[model samples]
Target chain A: MRVLLVEDEVRLADNLAAALRDGPGFAVDCAADGLSGDNLAGNRCYDLIILDLMLPRLDGLSLLRRLRARGDSTPVLILTAKEGKQAIIQLLNSGADDYLAKPFDLGELIARSKALIRRGKGQSHPVLSALGLEVNTLEQTVRRNGVLVDLSPTEYRILEYLIHHPRRVFSKRDLLEHLYDYNWEHHSNVIEAHVSNLRKKLDAAVPGAEPVIETLRGRGYRMAVGPEHTIEPG
Target chain B: MNQVKRSRSIAFHLIAAVLAVELLSSLLVGILSYGYERHIHFHAFDSILHGRVDSVIGAVQDAGDVDDNVMLDTADLHVPKDDIYEVFNSRGELLGRSPNWTGTSAPPAIPPHRHATFSEIKVNGREYRLLTQQGSRIVDPGDPGGGKLRHVTVIYGAPTERLWRAIHAAVQFYAAGSILLLAVTGPLIAWLLHRGLAPLRQLATLASRVSADSWHFSPPASARTTPELAPLTTAMENVLQRLERSFTQQRTFVSDAAHELKTAVAVVKSSLQLLGLRPRTQAEYQAGLERTLADTQRLEELVAKMLTLARVEDTGAAPGLPATVDLVQSMQQAAAELETVAKLHKIKVTMESPADEPVMVALTQEDCSLLLSNLLLNALQHSPPESTVELRTALQKERNTAEFSVRDHGEGIDPADLPRVFDRFYRSDPSRTRSTGGAGLGLAICKAVAERAGGSIALASQPGQGTTVTVQLPLTPNPDAASQLA
Candidate 1:
């Protein structure tokens, strides 16, 4: 899943972004200040936005307030050094999903981000289940009926996005945004390669398997969850 | 709503006081003035009544014939409209009376040859003033023969309603006048008070704008300025100055602390990332672990110093922490404990008084140690090798004060930077502060400890010369010595 991180501290933000991007393969876009973060949030789509309170042009609290006022329901997690109860209560009342104080561990930050994204898609656990198949988010592995199946990282991420969000249409731009960070120079065509490869791998795994990740021609992609005759007895 | 309450505002108090005094004095003056005016009018009216009596008697005597017959002439004398009279003979027989009294109710017949007297009589539901003139008079004015005098009594009755009417009118006018004055003066006094206190309102407006972020404070000028508000404005300006200074220091403390914490965290994070980036040999892994341990150790020390700074700054002269301790003893103990560090650095530490005289202060023993320890540590670390750090203790007996002063000979601070040397995280050479293992919070803690003990700390230094730091605390006398003296 992709996320947006808007924090002012350069070193902390850089390391956090690197960890989210290369470590767990969460596509993260970093904005150093509030105004630019607001602009990027409004123009593009991100599954979750990590906001910091103090910023250069506009403050994070006001940005969150304005963002929610415009009816954008993207889950927001606040990062702040302001420990006052009044500030926390106000931030929460102003539509903040959760908050973490400064000097927190990067690992804890990543876990919280993933949890928010998972809950936003209405999933119950880190492992997504659908179509008699299971995708393990933590192990980056896929399995059909208790048998392990190999998949590339990119293919796993795209399927991971679709498996978590079943029966939803995602345009190529949406898939690319969900899979890649804002810092990447993305051509929407890159998502076509990953989706087709994922479709091929899912069919090849079974003797006579239907395409699971179905592309709705001229639209985008949706997880195909249709009633089948039966699973072949192996 | 009509009930009165004790007001807290100065403007309300002033206006109420002025109105109360003015209202009471106005009522008194109005009553006195009305009574005086009536008294004067009554005195003048009495004289006029007596004159009318005398004129009527003269006319009667002049109209008298050779016989004892009284002929009253009422033509020449113009009697008042409200006056009535009657003349009586010696046998108490009525001879003549005024024309106004001919048909009206006659006054009572006063006895003839009685002394002239005046009285009040009521006739036909009206009050009259009666004057009885009794004396001897000639029967005929033209007779040259000496004749015996006849005693005649003249009873004159005058209506008293006119006098009361005049008095009533005067009293009514005075009451109306007082009511008018009260109505006008009440609002006038209120307006005057509001105008008088306008300067104070301006001062409050100016003071309210003084915040931690915005520090501009200027007293009101021109129309809003007054002599009575000058001292108040000056006091507020001084308070604002103090607040601004503290707020600036707090902001600096925050930024400096945040930078220190972030740098420490970044060091450990980067070190771990570099080690975990690729596979390494067992020895290299051990070396990397040792480096990370060193960084973590520094981080722990930094956190500890920050906590010490916070505690020292937070401790007030609280009831839970009150204990009287000997200052010299604490200072000497702290010095003795730090002697190892001093020896390691080749520094000489000496105390002027070695517990010979008890110099007591108002802080606890541990607090005194903390203050002295921080100061002495700062002095020792800044001093050159083989240099001397002297500890001096003295009691200013008259002021009941105890002082602990630390003097260090080192490459002293520059003159321009001397004032900020006690600031938290202040380093003369920013690069060497961490290398020297000083978080720059030593002197700041020393200042805080001294202040929390109800004392003050001062520092003086010059470039290339020695520096002196002084902690002056209020002295508390030993109870044993005091009891013996008593």
Candidate 2:
């Protein structure tokens, strides 16, 4: 599993990178501060991101938000020496997948990483399909018209949630709760915005496919079941 | 120099000395003046006595029988209102005298050696100066009608009462003039002393203002020429200049040390980040060493906090572009951010504000934000689970102060530890544990920030009770003080 490690403390970052490299089934790269970490996460590919909250040029929360803004679906785990629960909650809400307080157990950290990677691939199930759009869990890809479509890690997660449960009417709140680790403010509107962006990408990839998401006016949004509801490029 | 050691400053001592000498000499002059006036009164009274006796003798020579025409009633003798006289015949009869004199007659015998004499006598409990003169009557020895024998007679007198009154009035006038002179010249004496020591006072005030930040202590040019005090002034100026130079050097040393330490910390942090990116050969050991990395990260945080505290404590100003912040809004924002933490801890954290309007303070928004964040964190960390932490803000109107207080329901600190809570590296619980402790720099940093904003911090706690940390800041633009006399 590939991971991006962001920390400003040089010795600790170096030592952590060395340890992650030596750990079984893990490949880790490092960035000194939040700004560099954001750049690397945006331009490159990684399975997971290890972030530190305190950095000189840019802080971890802003970096996490920027990475998410760039449409990167990498799972992010926050590392911090701060014990305040507010800091932890803020990092989670801003796009972090998990957080480990400083002086965390190494075994627990590895286990958490594996769990995050598993979740990032969308809770691998027996069979998954949404509104006639089908995804093979084993192959980690989606298909329409019997044509295979390559899906990014984040696209796979979004498609996995819709495909796992079909015609059950999932609201945006439910999707956000199940997809992200932390809660956002009700006024954030980030969930709807991200979903719209995701729908556009999915429609482009699989032409003439039914729209997966349905807006349930004033209540939330859901995945539709009708054949005529094909998603346009947006 | 030693004589003036009791005085606080040389100017004070010089003024005191001059006033003392002036007082002593003025008193001596007053007494001397009284003495001279008394002397003149006595001499003038003697001359008046001689003139009265000469007129009496001229009248007696023209009278044929001394007892008949020269009977010498004081009214008949034509003496002025202030003079009196007495006549004695050959048989020594009492003749006339002034109205206030008490005696049967002039003394019968005159002193044999002198023509005129001055004497002192007592009458009615008052001492008087008496002048006497002896004269022989010229007579024909063959004529029975003339005095055949020359009688040796006596005369006595008293100080001229009129002369005494005149002299007393003159002495009183002089005494009053002396008092007026003293009154008029007192401020003049003070002004003179002040003028004489103007350079010294200036030099003193200048010396007092010399400090580490600015160390230029040169005595005023006017002081260089003062003949009496020039040496002392020059010596003081030299000493002050030396002190200023030393202070400047010390301040420079401190600033340099802080800058170097900051650079070194940055370098270390950056270097560690670079080293962390390299590949490692030992997989099993890296797994085991992950915890050590966590500890190293904690160490870096501790170092950064310690350096910040040291720098803030050394210089009492925060290195920030400070601006006025709304204190109430900052507290509200902090609470909103920390609500999730409060929920997790099962602690109810609420902000209690006095007014809906924002309470403005002379601190930047970031500083206010940081201060509130730290205070809330401390409150949440220390308070018991499920208990409430209360944050309050108030304006202490009487003292012209603005105050912020955070109260928690935790295990309070020991009384002895309260005083040192804000000291660097001071913690109530010193056990090295991540769950319940930090590097003990939080409160120290908060204190430095408050002091930098012209404020103060105080902590009060009782065992088994709650703890309240209060920060007090002085309000600006004292309108009440300005309008007080209006």
Candidate 3:
């Protein structure tokens, strides 16, 4: 999953971006001011955006309003230092998906970021499933037939994106956009290599298990769906 | 504990003064009317007495016997039953007397040359107004030209008890009229005064309702237009507005301080949390620790600056700090302390003054040093490399003030930011990082120190030219120096 962070404090922004990347293995993009944040949000596609209320050039509320005005439905998680019930109500009413006050726990922030991304993709549970395969989004791990499977961070991110949109055919470019931020270089062959590794690991976890991923000719990939796939409670 | 005396109500005082004047005037009118009435009644009584005496003399007639003497005609005489009279011929012998006369005191003897005399005499223990007169009557007027002329003296007296009663009745009438007038008008005056003073009462009620939490002051329209209450109403409105402004400023300051402190703490906390996120090599760990240490130091600097601002504001309220420090010496010490910072920035800091005399101002040494250091540091931060920051001092003899100014040749402030530069925690550029810009409390502290010492401070800036801050403090008079000069 890819996410965007808009914050003004240099150290706080750096720390939050690092935590999101390391904990959940999600690609994170950061904007230091409201104008640039607005500019990036308008031009990019992301599953979630973490915004700070106090910023230079344009305030957080104006940027949020502008984002919503343009009908961009990306889930926004607000970070604010202002203390008051009225301010919180105003933020939520202005299309903020969730809010966290300043000096928040790094662990909690990462957890919430992952949850927003999952919900943004219309998945209710923390763990996404397909035909005997289970991907735990919170821990960034995979299992097939209740057997743990080891995978690289890139391979896991590709598998995570495909499982979130089950049965939808995604081209190589779509997968690349969803799995990486602006900081990463995108090459169509890179997506092929990661997906190939991810498929081998899932099939190897249980020798007799059916394949959990399918490739359509000329259309990149989709999660394998069958009567055996059932979502588990988080 | 001392008890405060409750002030008297204005309405009560006004009513009392009006009633007093009414009662005094009533008494004066009563006394003057009584005297006038008595004088008129007495004059009418005297005229009636004189007429009665003339009637008595007319009753004297000639005696029908030889020797030509006049005799009193008892049958033809007419007078009041309470009156007494006597008649006599020129021989001084009594001819006749009234039937009511038991004259224990003889009428005063009248001189023959006098025509009449009137006196108040007591006869038989009763007061009388008596008139004695000499007159002539014609006896036998049928004779040739006229009958023989016979001169006679008559004395008549009337009891004055009824006259005294009439005069007493007149005086009583005047006193009753005055008392009645006072009774009818006393309450009327009181009610009129109360109606006239309604605006004042309304003004008091409105003023009494004002408090710090609520600053609403809308005086009654009548009060505003009334000549007596207009100035008072205006003064009260002005005072309330001033108090509200001061309270709002205090609230804003507290909220801003809280915001700055919270942001600083968040920075340090996030830095530490980021360092502990993953296991790393020893070298990486060492670098992370050093970065976190730097974040903590910035937080510490913010907290210290906040405390300094609070201390300066607190002491500013209490007066009478000893003005023992020499301005020149304090400036030198401040400049010396900041020399290393200037050297690092590659900026020149220089001091200039017209004279080398010691300029003593009303401030303590610690406050003087703090003020100068804050100003100098601000100048050094904004000054460009190889530029000069000038510190100029002078004694303004005519104004009895010691003046100093700090001028920096750097990028000056925007006109919009100049007005709020002395406000606590106000930064002209919101994007300036904490490392490049101090916590924005330096100028605010300098202003507080300057005002606390009975001094004034002002700032002037142009966008491209430069910025200059001037401060003036009252100079402490030196008696020994003055004597030496003399």
**Listed models, DockQ each:** 0.05, 0.01, 0.44
TM-score of chain A of each: 0.92, 0.52, 0.94
Specify the CAPRI tier of model 2.
Answer: incorrect
lDDT of each: 0.77, 0.66, 0.82
- lDDT, residue A205, candidate 3: 86
Candidate 3 per-residue lDDT, tens place, A1-234, comes to 778889877767777888788778878898888998998898657889899887767889999999999999999999888888999999999999999887777777877887788888888898887766788886778888789999999998888888887868889988888778898888999989888888888888888777778888898798877556654544
- Which regions in candidate 3 have their CA more than 4 angstroms from the true location? A1-10, A13-17, A20-137, A140-234, B1-5, B50-58, B63-101, B109-190, B276-288, B315-321, B324-326, B355-360, B394-403, B473-476, B479-486
RMSD of each: 11.9, 25.2, 5.2
Q: List the residue pairs that clash in candidate 1.
A: none
What's the number of clashes in each of the models? 0, 5, 0
Total residue pair clashes for candidate 1? 0
**What clash pairs does model 3 have?**
none
Q: Can you rank all candidates by lDDT, best first?
A: 3, 1, 2
What class would a CAPRI assessor give candidate 1's docking? incorrect
- Per-residue lDDT of candidate 1, residues A69-184 (tens digit): 99988889988766669879999999998988766666677778888888787775888877767887877789876667788888888888887767788899888877887667
Candidate 2 reaches a DockQ of: 0.01
User: B254 in model 1: Cα distance from truth in Å?
Assistant: 3.0
